[model samples]
Target: MYSPALQPLFQSLLSTLADLNLAYDRDREKLSESMKDANLRTRALEKLKQQHHERREPYLQQLAILQDRIQRGWH
Candidate 1:
């Protein structure tokens, strides 16, 4: 088990990650359900890609930092 002090932080991080995953899933579903027109579908998917990247990068960075910190703590 993780240290008592770190468990809450771990849970919070997991919750954030779960939320991000759900948002991404919804965005993907929207992309799949977008207009049948080829050009419109392409545009919609690209827009979603850009938005997802913008949101995910920072979250992934933070997650990586947290992982690094945990690994360092373990040593």
Candidate 2:
């Protein structure tokens, strides 16, 4: 039975993608909650959006790198 050593890379790619989706969902949920709360200010919403971008960027980069590696198809 031959297995490509790229399994870990594939796993990481899938996990990173799922994490990116979760981060997006969190951002949407936070915005929805903040929008519903009158006491929360516009600054709070802006901060949440910024936080989401900051958090998701690394995962986005990692996913791109992993896909690149998989595409290379190492022997």
Candidate 3:
């Protein structure tokens, strides 16, 4: 049993520590979620770049072929 004179001080201290713990947990969760979102975005961007490169490679080859044909025709 707590002494009546010390009960209020203990209660206030307990409540303050509980609030601080809750806020700290919330901040930690938010940071974890943000990091996960950033990782996903980075992966998506890398995939998009890879797809663009694959799509453009054929076009570049065709342009080169056309340029060679034009040069040979002129000579």
The TM-scores of all predictions, comma-separated, are: 0.72, 0.54, 0.46
Candidate 2 residue 32 Cα shift, in angstroms, is: 4.0
TM-score (C-alpha, index-matched) for candidate 1: 0.72
* Tens digits of per-residue lDDT for model 3, 1-75: 433554455455556556655765565555556656777757655665566566556555655554565557622
- Residue 21, candidate 1: alpha-carbon lDDT: 76
1-75 per-residue lDDT for model 1 (tens digits): 345676677678778778877998898787778677878888888888788788777767776776787778842
Stretches off by above 4 angstroms in model 2 are 1-4, 16-31, 34-40
What lDDT is reached at residue 56 by model 3? 55
Model 1 has an lDDT value of 0.76
The order by descending lDDT is 1, 2, 3
Best by TM-score: 1
Candidate number achieving the greatest lDDT relative to the actual structure: 1
Cα lDDT of model 2 by residue, 1-75, tens digit:
113776776677678768867987787676767586654746676776788788778777876776676667644
Off by over 4 Å in 3: 1-36
Instruction: Provide the RMSD of all predictions against the true structure, rounded to 1 decimal.
Output: 2.4, 4.1, 31.7
Q: How many clashes (backbone N, Cα, C below 3 Å) per candidate? A: 0, 0, 0
Q: Find the 10 residues in a row with the least total lDDT in model 2.
A: 1-10
Alpha carbon lDDT of each predicted model:
0.76, 0.70, 0.57
Question: Model 3 residue 44 lDDT?
Answer: 58
